[model samples]
Structure formats: structure tokens, C-alpha cells
Target chain A: MSFINVLSREINCKIVYYGPGLCGKTTNLQYIYNKTNPDAKGKMISLATETERTLFFDFLPLALGEIRGFKTRFHLYTVPGQVFYDASRKLILKGVDGVVFVADSQIARTEANLESLENLRTNLAEQGYSLDKLPYVIQYNKRDMPSVAPVEELRELLNPNKVPDFEGVASTGVGVFETLKAVAKLVLTEVKRQAG
Target chain B: MATEPKRVFGSLEELMTNPQMVMYEEEFNQIQAIVVRLVKEANARVVFVIDKNGQEIAKAGETDQLDTTSLASLTAGNIAATGGMAKLLRENEFTTQFHEGERANIHIQIVGNRVILVVIFDSKTSLGLVRLRVKKASEELNSIFEALLRKVQDPNRETPFAEITDDDIDNLFND
Candidate 1:
């Protein structure tokens, strides 16, 4: 869900980067936070353990271009990728206007990718949001890594819904903005439809 | 200076016309007082109230620099979504949610009839004090909101949105 504030002429939406452990979910947000103009972004918050594994979640708020005089702000978040963090993942998906399901493309992590997608469905349903109905996209991250699953195979396995999927090397910033823009576009389109 | 009344009217007129809305004035005053004290006593930077739909009802303290309405709306959505999950999974109500950052932290609690109160602060305040202060404020707010909801539903309710025709809504689309 998005909150459109008529008083301040701004719209705020939440977008979550979800994937299995070590699938580059946090890296995706970190890269964007680093690349975005300082004025357009807020402080990036990461709740992680001493080993650098995500403890709870990561958050970054970015201001996209204004529309109809309202500042379009997207609160980007990443859920802990570990399977044990199911509760935390569910919490992060709450009120998600759009989702960027970052699937690990490594051949060895294929099962993890499938499990994470299923997990996404279970979590989204628990939040009363249907994965099929909501504005959602998929990202094949860590494509640059060796032993990666083929993009075609990954798509066939994960994105049966075929929602605008991208191949990204999040650490190097490849396809990062594309992923963000695709989700942002879908979200804004939802707003237009709602208002109309 | 002259903007105060207009600003209030602009934000407050949504549900203000009902004959049963008599408590609105008192409730608004009370909420304002509680928020002011929370900010001062808790050493908070910002405090605000967001309706179930995420609209900003009233806000005080360090709100001018940021977009309260958007924050309120998004935060409300977050609470509502999580609240919905709690209901679906047969869990108890989610009382509060907090997000701690390097420089700032937000403390949010669900109040009467699905409304949310959010306080944003930094290292200046302790979470224990903020939580206690918010708990007290939430109880007081719950009653006021309950009364306000009754007023909203009191058969004698008048809706300004009702006066807005389909054409008006369509015109919003055009612009």
C-alpha cells in the first residue's frame, strides 16, 4: 500500500528486495544508496550481525522525480535472506507497493532460488497481498558470478509470471537502476489507476 | 501568521461537519498537548498522527522540514499491512514497530480504530523513555479516537467527499 499525502503533495511507497541468503539483496540497496545523489537519498540503515549477515533488514529512502507536484518517495528495503529469517521477511513485505525478487543465478543456488520464490508467495499472502495481483518484478542478480544458472533457466524456473525481469550484477551497479525504475514505474502506474 | 487557521481548516475539514463531531475540538486539543509533551519530555525530534489511510491528521515538532503526510501515509500502510498479517495468521495485535538507523530511529504504535502515532528521534532520547511516554499517550488517544469514530458514524454524519461529484474525481484525473 502507498500513502498519498495531499497536504505535502508527496506519495510514499515501499519496495522490498527479497532473495535467498548471499543472493545480493543488500548489495543491491547499498549500490543504489551509494550511486544516488546525496540530497535525493536518506541515510541507509542496515541491521546486521558481527559476521556481516543481515540480522533484521536494510532500509534506504530515495526520492524519485516529482509527479503532479508531489514528490515521489520510494522506501527501499531488503529482507534478511537466511531461511531462518522468515518472520523478518514477512515483516518487511508488509505494505509493499512493489517487489524486486532478486533471484540468485548460481547453478548451485537454484534450489535456494526456488525456495525463496515460494517463501515470497507465502509471506505476501500472509500479508493479504496476492503475488499475482500486486505490482511485482523479478531480478536475476549475481549474473557475473561463475557457476551461475543460465538466465533462460532461471526465468523458466522462477518468473513463470513473467513480470519484467532483469539480470543484474548489483555489486557493480549493473541493472540496479533498471530494476528500480521498472518497479517505480509499475508503482506510479498503480497510483494513476487508483486516482483515476 | 495568518496561515495557521487556514492550514488547520485545510487538514481538519474532512470529517469536521458532523453534528456528532462535537468532540473534535477537544480531541484535537488533547492530541496536540500529548504530542507536544512527548516531544519535549522524550527529547524527540518529530511527532505526528496518521489516519488509517495515511493522511496526516495533526503534527507537531520538527515537521516543517519533512513531508509528514507522505511519512504518515506510508507508515500507516506499513502498520495496516502488518496488522492485516497478524489477523490472518491468528496472532495478537502488533502493538508497536521500531526502525533504528545510524542517525535516526522511528517508533510507531497503532492507536484507536487503526490510526498510528509515529515519533522520529535520534540519540538524544532513550528508547525506554519514548516507549513509556508513547504507551501512556496511546491509551489516552485510544479513547479519544473511539469517540471520534462514533461521531463519524453517528447517522447525522455529513461527508464533504459526498459533495464531490464523479466529475470532480474525474477532473482530478485530468489535472
Candidate 2:
């Protein structure tokens, strides 16, 4: 859910980075946190287990400058992609405004990506939301890996709806901003259409 | 805007366009003041008035060492997990939670069934004193948010983003 504070003249939207475990969801957040100008970002928090796998989620609050008189703030979150963390994933999607599915591109992880997308659909459905209708995008991540699936194959499996999608190596920041920008645009556009 | 639980959206367009939370400047300042006073009275290190959706509406106290953005998100998750537990146990909601650390502790309270108030303190204050102060603060905070919800639902209220254009949003990413 987007929080539009007329008093502060700010728009706060929640965007979740979701995918299977170790699909670089956290990495996408870390890269954005590292690259964002200090003034434009808040503290990036990661609730991870001892081994560095995200136990619950990672959060990064970003200021995307102002459009007109209202400042736009996007709260970026990443769910624990491990399958057992289904409950945690559901909690994170409570008021989500947009979603960026960061799919692991390695050939071996295709099934995991598909399962995670299906999980996203079910969880959103439980919340009275449909992934088909939400402001959504896909990032074919880990594109730098040698065994990465062909973009065509990844799209055939993940981009059935043909939503705005990108290929990225989140660790190095490639296509990270593009992916974020695409979803952010869609969200703002949705807000505009709704606010009218 | 009146918190009508059964209100129909009419169509997906209505559902997709409606914002979940709205705050006016005057009310935000009022809530901010309450948070500031709560911090002083409770002798807490930091106090956060966050929407249950994990948005930090207002904050007070020394937050330099604190990652309040993360704190707000985690607190909401913690509360939601507890709420889920409450459902499983056939209870309405837990409403309050506290986690005691060796040196610092956290006290969380749900207010108005919409927002969560979290107080982080250490030896600087006792739990009893914090609880007493929060009880009063929560009541005040609850009323403020109630009014906020009503105002947000007002159909006549002006929306600042109504004038935003695609070109304007694109400009933000230009840099």
C-alpha cells in the first residue's frame, strides 16, 4: 500500500524484491544501498541468519527525488527466499505497492524461480491482491554467471505476461537501476491514475 | 475513508488507485509532538510511531545509532507474526510485545489497530515507568490517527500527486 502524505508532500510506496533463496534479492538491495547518494537513502537493514542468508528480510528506504511538489520515497524490501519462510513472505507483502522478482538466471535454478513466482501469486491472492494486476517487473539476475539461462528461455518461463523485465548482475549493479526505475515508473503511473 | 470494512471497491480500478495511508501536515506534527513528549517522559532512547504496514509515520529521541527504517519494518513484522499467532490461538490480537536484551530492551504496543508504537530503552529507565508512560501516550496517539483516517477518507481532500505526469516521474530517474 502506498502512503501519500499530503502534509509532508511525500509519497511512500513499498516495493518488495522477491525470488527464490539466494537469487540475489539481498544483493540487489545492498547494491542500491551502496550506490544511492547518502542524502537520498536511509540505513539499509538486513535481518539475516549467522550464515548471511536472509532470515526474514532486507529493507532499504530510498528517496527518488521529487515529482512536482511531492517527494517520492520507496521502501525496498527483500523476503527470505527460502521456501520454509512462506509465512515471512506473506507478512512482507501486506501493503506492497510494487514487486521486482529477481530470478536467479543459472540453468539449475529455473525450477526454483518458477516455484517462487507461483508462491508470489498465491501469497498476493491471499492478501486480496493479484500479481497479474499489481505493478510488477522481473529481473533475470546473475546474468554474469557462466551457466546462466538464455534470456529467451528465462522470459518464456517468467515473463508470460510480458511485464517490463530486465537482465541484471545485481552484484555489480548492472540493470539494477533500470529494474527499479521501470517498476517505480509503473507504480507512480498507477498512483497518478488512481489519485485522479 | 471512514474505515468502512465492507465498502466495495466497485472495480479493480478503484482498488488499484486508492492509497492505503494518508497523512496531513497538521496531524503529522501533532503526532510528532506526542512522540517527542513520550520519549522524554518514558526515558527511552528512541520512539517510533509506525503504520502496521511498516511505514514510519513519526519518530523521536536520539536515533543516530539506530537504524529506525529497519527498526520500523522489523517491528511491523514482529507484530504481524504475533497477530498471526493470536489468530491461531483464537485471540483477537496480542497488541503488546517486549523483548528484553542484556543492556537494551524493546516494548511494542499496537495502537488504534492500525499503527504500532515501539520504545527502545536501556538502564536509563525501568519497564514499569515505560509502560505507564506508553499507556497514556498510546491513547493520545490513537485519537490522532483516528482523526487522520477520517480526514484521509474525505473525498474532497486535495491529492498533491494528481498533477504528476509520466515525464515528471521519468525526470527523477534521469540522474
Candidate 3:
């Protein structure tokens, strides 16, 4: 859901980054935070354990260029990826406008990816949302890893929807904006459709 | 009002563009004047009027540079979550809350029975003054908003989004 301001002619949407543990979910946000123009973003807040994995979520708000007359803002968040933090993940998914499923491309983490995806479907169902129906996308992350699964195989298994999937090395910001833009676009389009 | 459940708009745009578009220049000015007066009367450094969904409509003092959007959204989320908690506990609603920190204190009150009024202040303002001022402002705001709703429900009002084309929306996706 979005918070709309008629005075400012703006809409704010929440987009969540979700995936399994150590899947670069937090890293994606950090990279974007580091590279974003200072004027375009607010302080990035990370609720993390001592080990640096997200505890609840990581929040970063980005201002994309305006659409029509309204300034489009997206609040990006990453859920704690560990299985034990399932409760926190469900809490973060509340009121989400769109989702970016960041998958660890490493071959060793294939089962982890599948498990996380299943968890996502289940949690979304609990909240009365469906992954297939929502504006959802997949990001095959950590492409730099030599042990990562091939893009084709990852697509076949994870992105059957063909929603704008990206091959990303988030730490270096290769496909970070691409992924962000894809989700932001989907969210804004959804807003327009809802308005009409 | 009837006991029928309040509708939940699935998205921000939907809520803003609902057939019940409730705003006009006169009410807008009235709201701004009331906010300015309320801030001064309350002796507060800042005062903001956030929509029921937590979108900042207008603010007075110390708010020009702040990202009110994020704050408004979070406030809305907090209120919704709190309201849900109240229902779970079989209560009516969570009316208000106060948070006092070392350097600053915040008074968050629900106004117009729909919006939230947030006053951020320091030692410059007293709690008594803030409460008295907010009480007065809330009543005035409540009436103005009720009239604004009637204006919104008028059959002659035009929609802002009626002119937008699908291609324009698609262009937003062209990265």
C-alpha cells in the first residue's frame, strides 16, 4: 500500500527485498545506499544482529523521477533471511506493494533458494497476496561467484513468470538500479491502474 | 456513521482518487491557517497534518526540508498496526500516544477522526499548551474536513487522473 500526499503530489510505496540467508539481500540495499546521490535518499536503517545479517529489515527510501505530476518514492526493505526469523519476515511483508526475490545464484544454495521461495509464497498467502498475481520479480544475485548456477537454469526454476529478472552482482552495483527501476515501475503502474 | 466496516483502499492512489476526493482550495487554506495558529498556540517547533493513510498534507515550522513522506507513511503504519492491536484486545481504537526523548518530545493525536496530528517540540513548548491548542485546532479541522468531503462527493468535480493515458503509465516503466 502507498501513502499519498495531495499537497506534495507524491506517492510512497513499499517494496520488499526477500530471500534466503546470505543471499546478498542486505548487500543489494547497502550497495544502492552507497551509490545513490545524497539528495535522492534518506538515511538507510538496518536492524541487524551482531553478525550483520538483517534482524528485522533494512529500510532505504529512493526517489525516482516523477510520473505525471506526482513524485514517486519507493521504500525498499530487506527481510531477515534466516529461517528462524520467519516471524519478522512476515511482519515486513505486511502492506508491501511489490517484491524483489533475490536468489543466491550459487549452486550450493539452490535448495536454500527453493525453500525461501516456498516460504515467500506461504507468507504472502497468509497475508492474502499471491506471488503470481502481485508485481513480483526475481534477481539472480552474486553472479560473480564461480560456483553460481547458470542464468538459464536459474530462470527455468525460479523465474517461470518471466517477470523482469536480472543477473546481478549487487555488491558492485551492476544490476542494482535495473532491479530497483523494474520494481518501482511495476508499483507505479499498479497505482495508476488502481486509480483508473 | 453506520456500523458498516470502513473500506480499506488497496493502494495510495486508489485512496486518493476514490470517488470521495475530499479537498478544495478554501479548505486547504483553512487547514494551513489552522495548522500555523495551532503550532504557535501550542508553542511547538513543528506541526504536521497527515492523512489517515499517513501522507503529509501540509506542515508548519521545521518541516520544509524533512522527508515528511517517509514519516507520514511510518506513522500511518504505526497507527494501523496499533488499531489492529486494539481490535485484537477488544478495544475501540488507540487514540493517542506521547514519546519523550532527552532533547525532544512528540505528541501524536488523531484529528478529524481520520487524520493524525504530530507535534514535535523541545523545551519551548509545554504539554498543557500543546494539548489545549491541539484540542481547538482539531475541532476546526474536523468541520473543515467534513465540508471538504461534501465538496468531494459533489458530482461536478473533475478527477486529476482522468486525462492520463496507458502509454504515459507505460513510459514510467521505460528504464
Query: DockQ (Cα-based) per candidate?
Result: 0.08, 0.48, 0.20
> Candidate 1 on A39-103: residue-level lDDT in tens?
99877777799999998777788888665466778888888999997877886775577899998
Model 2 per-residue lDDT at B137: 95
Clashing pairs in 2: A1-A95, A7-B25, B1-B153
Candidate 3 local lDDT, A1-196, one digit each (tens): 5655466666777799999999988999999999889888987877788988787677788887666886777888888999998866876776678999999999999999999999999988766567876678889999999898899999999988789999999989878889888887777666665544
Number of the predicted model whose TM-score against the real structure is largest: 2
Cα lDDT of model 2 by residue, B97-166, tens digit:
9999999999999997888999999998999999999999999998898787767667887766778887
Report model 3's interface C-alpha RMSD after superposition on the true interface residues: 5.4
User: After TM-score superposition, what is the CA distance of residue B32 in candidate 1 from its true location, in Å?
Assistant: 6.6
Best by lDDT: 2
Least accurate stretch of 10 residues (summed lDDT) in model 1 chain A? A187-196
Which TM-score value belongs to model 1?
0.68
Which candidate do you rate higher for DockQ, 2 or 3? Answer: 2
Off by over 4 Å in 2: B1-19
List clash counts for every candidate, in order.
3, 3, 0
TM-score of chain A of 3: 0.98
Evaluate residue A152 in candidate 2 and report its C-alpha lDDT on the 0 to 100 scale. Answer: 97
